[model samples]
Target: MRLYIDPGTGSMLFTILIGLVGAGIYSARMLIVKLRFILSGGKKVDMNANRIPFVVFADHKRYWNIFEPVLREFDKRGVDVVYMTASPDDPGLQNPYPHIRGEFIGEGNRAFAKLNFLKAGIVLSTTPGLDVYQWKRSKEVQCYVHILHAASEATLYRMFGIDYYDSILLSGEYQATDVRNLEKLRNLPAKDLVEVGIPYMDEMKVRFEKAGPAPKHETTVLLAPSWGPEAIFSKYGDQILKVLLETGYHIIVRPHPQSYTAEKDMIETIMKKYPESDRIEWNRDNDNFEVLRRSDILISDFSGVIFEFAMVYDKPVIYTAANIDTSVYDAWWLDTPLWTTGILPRIGHELNGLNLPMLHSIIDECLNDTRYAKGRDEARSEAWEHMGEGAVRTVDYLMKKYRELNPAERPDKEA
Candidate 1:
């Protein structure tokens, strides 16, 4: 008899094996720290004697837009901050701010190792899964603040992603309610949930205002989907493109950046199958404002870009009907339905096998429909409040928290 294992089980086993290896590495590192302390006759290691007062960590360069405004606020107020990133080519490294110092700290496990031993008064990050994966909380760090990069629900993160964080800066009050629900469900201590609005969207609004309107062109459809099994491209691939091309409308496909790396083979196959032409163009621009401006209607799955389009662009969206598996996410713990899914029907139309054949009609409806306008206004109010004041409010919260953690080193005035 031959032994057999399914792909799902095999993947799960591999993940467990990797996790065990990581645990061993972490144990060894801690043992070394302990041994050093014992050898020094009960004295602390003091790896970072000159502790940094404020620190910001970016796991990828893509999030620079989200942090740039806050860093600028810090600079304008004459406050010092350390910007650490895993990507060597991060734009934050090139920032001319006198008060902000940026440094590249390698990537993956190496970056996590450096962060696990950091010493800071308050460490702010957009990345989640602290103390759940490779990134462990450092004892020397007084506070860990996690800020949302999207206007979506905070429960959408992977299991226990933000559970260990000291505080979470939310974009809306609904998110705070969900966070509190999770805390009560898990018997966890409630952390600070501040509704500071969406900083990147505010920045995008400024850029859009300066760039003016997009040049007039043919009716355009932007297909921007999240990168995962539940995403549109991952499920239907070029089939969706074939359907859109039949409508004789210009189509733009801007895949999630992660698709280029995580699903490289899938993207390559799709691109090879349907090469770019005058009618069909593939977009991979770091900044999506140009493409977004030229688009009439958006076709997406569960990507946060939907909120950006509906809120910032003030346009309508056609979301694909894909069943998102929530078992691996914090959302599984909640009994209520996801807020994103609940609001989709109001703000846009749905695309699935039943309505896929009539995608052209749906696109036409979304483009010409005036009813969704109200939903867009309601969504904007719920997901993003105090639209243009995000950066200022974010800085205010950080400065106040820092002072609370270090009273002796408090500044004379707030930023």
Candidate 2:
């Protein structure tokens, strides 16, 4: 009796059988937690425990955008917000919570603060080392919201961003949809994702609503370029400073913080060369978005600042990817034609300007181009809708999660 299972049927059967086995394994693991921890551990498990956390992550930088709001929320609730730091010598360590000033606590104990938060019905997380360091405690009802300390763009940035939180705050739908399809979250279990727009944009919005007239004779342009495989400095980067400064434009050389050393040296050399050029200024300490809010134009590389500027400021952007390797850089920018997608696919502008004359011509043409200005405005409108204007929406959602639960019901931190 030859009861033959065809190869195709055999493969299908094998797959289904494997799936069942994997499911069985997960089911067994859950059963063990319930039976061993809850049933056998025999300690009365508080079926209801407080879980709304006083949110802030390790070594919280004081100047962060969300600092004030998070503090206000915790104070209203009578909970202490946690802050960790490596610099004990840092002046003015005044706060309601215990500040653990220690060597970047070893990974094993990095989440040492989480236990404290869990005891207080809260979980605060930031950065790669801390996110993975804790969360293994796995308090099912705990609220774990991640307030990104910085803005995100590019597919690669989000992909590398998955390891450290319970919930994510997205800038807008493009970012949400963009992130949803990203290959990075593919491995992550589905969790809550929030699209409340960026928190700092809220700060930008307040000033804009009370918007006063701009300073006459002062048109500030921020020169921001990425710092990586194809940094602006490698390309016609210096050309921007020389052309804008030599002319009469108010140029603010706000390069990436990562370019601190290079930018410093460049600024020193340029200042000596152009002592009479007071029209251009250098401001590194300004909030990035605030600078974008005031800028008349943005000269950048493949930085997210371009998308933000295009969407928010609706201003002309002159990009010089001349130093970027065709093999590596993604040529798809917000709306203006990219060199890779058959959208004006080949620009031969120099990426550097160390005594180069062509760079000046490129900057002049871009600043003066009517078509470039129109495209920038159009792109900004689209980005504004996509990014949304409410940074408070993210905070509101975090608060909503708190209101839904009984704080007294969250699990207490285990000793």
Candidate 3:
């Protein structure tokens, strides 16, 4: 104390002391993790296994509809695939295929996700931005494949995230052209973008075929909007529901799942205000096929459901123009300069969300008018031209890429 050290010197000394302590703690924690890994035989099984692991990563249970059929194809072909999900409580892991291994990595736990990825030889997913930025496992897997869950264009995803994928499976020509344009614009390496149709829709079409057509009714309209700031549910949910309900047409309100996350209170209030009648109902079921099959016409706002409804059910849709202010998204909208082009007069009749009178008019027109019927057919054909039998092709592509990567350990023949 009598030495009278200067304030600057004392501050520097304190900073150094804190840094040393932090580094010491980090080193100790890492040492413990390494020891635990060894003790738990993680490396032993992962590194020395005779069969290479094929993994499908799912971020949510909603995607089970897409991955289940593809996983079934693998099972049928005698391929042993592992299903890894971020949700620990995901129901998909409960009754997994006999040959398929299911693992649930802790949700939002990057360390566990990386550990799971380290064990996978080939990884496939429809979930975008898997470990692209933080705690990346890009180098862990031999090949990472991106499958389009929606028919939207490539710009909907971050360019850097798409770049992280080794291959992409497109649903239609729009996605293919968009990916190529992105590749040229960003000067990034060309990714293997194959038009594999909609893999999820393949299964739905089979079910629909088996179920046959739904019975016609007096104007059944499903109001299925997407999630986000521009979502019709947030802006005109009350007005739209009120107007449609008053019209006495059977209405099914199937808001996007993410809508609950963004506006839970608002949705709850809507439900309480408008008690459900046989004529009106709020649906939260994970499966939308039944809703789409039953509904005669759909009224939505810039949602992928527009394409799914139009292409799958072969019906007309009334779309609300997206007056989206992307600025609120923290520069996220900058990635997709062409996002609006994906939806528009391309598939549905466009209308302003706030215009109640016009919205009602368009609903009537969509129900009765045959002029847009031809346009719907054209759009459906162009969007899902490869609808049927694409799941088989997707499995074929996965195996092909797997063989290319592991030439030495390739399967002698396809199962």
lDDT of 2: 0.49
Give, for candidate 2, the lowest lDDT window spanning 10 residues: 339-348
lDDT of each: 0.88, 0.49, 0.71
Give the worst 10-residue stretch by lDDT in candidate 3: 325-334
List, residue by residue over 145-193, the lDDT tens digit for candidate 1: 9999998889899999999999999888889988999999999998988
Give the range where candidate 1 is weakest over 10 consecutive residues by summed lDDT.
406-415
Off by over 4 Å in 2: 1-52, 58-63, 66-143, 148-154, 158-160, 182-187, 218-220, 226-229, 237-240, 262-271, 274-276, 286-294, 307-314, 322-391, 403-415
Error of 2 at 188 (Å): 3.6
**TM-scores for candidates 1 onward, in order:** 0.86, 0.60, 0.80
The parts of candidate 3 lying over 4 Å away from their true place are: 1-51, 110-112, 115-117, 324-343, 411-415
**How many clashes show up per model?**
0, 14, 0
- For candidate 3, lDDT tens digit of each residue in 1-415? 4788797676456445544554565467557767878888775333324435588888777787778878888877878887878877777788468766777866754433343325457888876654443324433367788887776665566535576677998877766776776677667788888877777887777888888788867778888888777777677768788788777789998888877877888888888888788989888886677888889888888787787777777788888777655443312434645534543575567766446756667778776777677776666566675768677888889988887777657542353
Q: What's the TM for model 1?
A: 0.86
Clashing pairs in 1: none
